[model samples]
Target: MKIGLYFGTFNPIHTGHMIIANHLAEHSDLDQVWMVVTPHNPHKQKNTLLDDYHRLEMVHLATKDFPKLQPSDVEFKLPQPNYTVNTLAHLQEKYPQHTFSLIMGEDNLNSLHKWKNYEVILQNHSIYVYPRLASGEIDAQFINHPKIHRIGAPVIEISSTFIRESIKNKKNVVPLLPEKVWHYIDHNLFYKK
Candidate 1:
């Protein structure tokens, strides 16, 4: 099985996340898209994120209807301060029968060189990149790389920050989230601070 790993914090899974994953699952060659819920992102403040299990639950809720879109807690049990290289290596060793690929955005591609053991990643697995509203230029070396595929996914500009802020402000952000996810956030009163 060729699985595309869509890693994220998923503070609260939104419609945009679903749309992108569904597009890749249905239109691309990937057999499934696993929404890997990271415990914490090094780039973002840990305090700003919801509990690991809560976020994972939201992913499960959001993906329940989409068979090809499944949620993953693979990063939850991993050591804190997780790195993609380690995750990839672990996944490979754990699931030798299934090939795993990365699903990232154009912005992330721009900074791929700085990640630990990035060369090892490129050498071992395929990368499915979607467009992002970022200004950083993608390094030239990745332009024609056979391992990196620029999947023509729609430019979903929705931000978790925006959703959090709206929720804190008591705005109607129901449309931005999956119905069950919205209910979960509302019922738990998350991001209301």
Candidate 2:
């Protein structure tokens, strides 16, 4: 089985995450797309994130209906601050029968070189990159890379940052999240100021 690992904080696992995961599963050769919920991303700030277990639960809740979409607590048990390369290594050992690929935004592809042992990741695993607003031109750097492929996924500008701010201000997030996720956020008073 071939698995595409979609790694993120999934602060609340909004609709955008669902859309991409579904798109990947429907369009790609991947057998499954696992939402690898990180306890702490090495490149991002931790203060803005919710509790790791809570974030993981939100992903689990949001993806309950999709059999191809699974929430992974793999990073939770691993060392942190979590690095994608490390998680990939761990997963390879744990699931030797399954071929592991990476599903990420074009933006993340831009920063791949800065990740630990990134060369190894590029050489070994196939990466499916969905387009995102680029901070700069890193595509040119990897244009010749053998393992990277660009995917035609919908461009969703909605982000966890926008969701957090909306919740903080008591604004409607109905359109941005799934109904169950919205209810969970409201019931837990998550991000309430």
Candidate 3:
């Protein structure tokens, strides 16, 4: 099976994420897209993030109805910071029979050099980059790489930060989040100011 790893914090899985994952699964060469919920991202601010288990549950509730999209909690047991390189290595070791690919936004690709063991990741795995609103073109060096593919998935400007802020300000985020996710957040009083 060809699995595309779509790694994110998924503070609350929203429609934008679902659209991209579905697009990748249906349009790309991937058999399924696993939304890998990272417990902690080394590059992101830690204080703003919700608990790992809460974030994982939100992803589960949001993706439960999508057959091609699977929510993954593999990083919950991994080390802190949850580096992509380590996750990829671990997944490869654990599931040798499955061919894994990396699904990311074009913005991430622009900063690929800043990541740990990026060269190893590029050389070993296929990267499917979807367009991001305002994210510029990829670097010239990787423009023609065989393993790097730029897909035409629709770009949604909604972000997790925006969702959290809206919730804190008592703004209705029903349009941004999945129904079950919003219900869970509201019922649990998540992100209350």
Query: Top model by TM-score, which number?
Result: 1
Model 3, 1-193: lDDT tens per residue?
9999998888878889999999999999899999998786666777768888898899899889888899999988898766788989999999999988999998888888789998899989999999988778678878898989999999878999999899999999999989999999999998877
Report, for every candidate in turn, its global Cα lDDT versus the true structure.
0.92, 0.87, 0.90
For model 1, how does the per-residue alpha-carbon lDDT over 132-176 read when each residue is reduced to its tens digit?
Answer: 877388799999999999888899999999999998888999999
- TM-score of model 3 relative to the true fold? 0.94
Residue-pair clashes per candidate: 0, 0, 0
Q: Specify the poorest-scoring 10-residue window by lDDT in model 1.
A: 39-48
**Relative to the unseen true structure, what is the C-alpha lDDT of residue 144 in candidate 1, on a scale of 0 to 100?**
99
* TM-score-based ranking: 1, 3, 2
- The model with the greatest lDDT is 1
* lDDT per residue (tens digit) for residues 73-117 in model 2: 998888767678888999999999999999989888888888899
The segments of candidate 3 whose C-alpha lies over 4 angstroms from its true place after superposition are 41-45
Q: How do the predictions measure up, each by TM-score?
A: 0.96, 0.94, 0.94
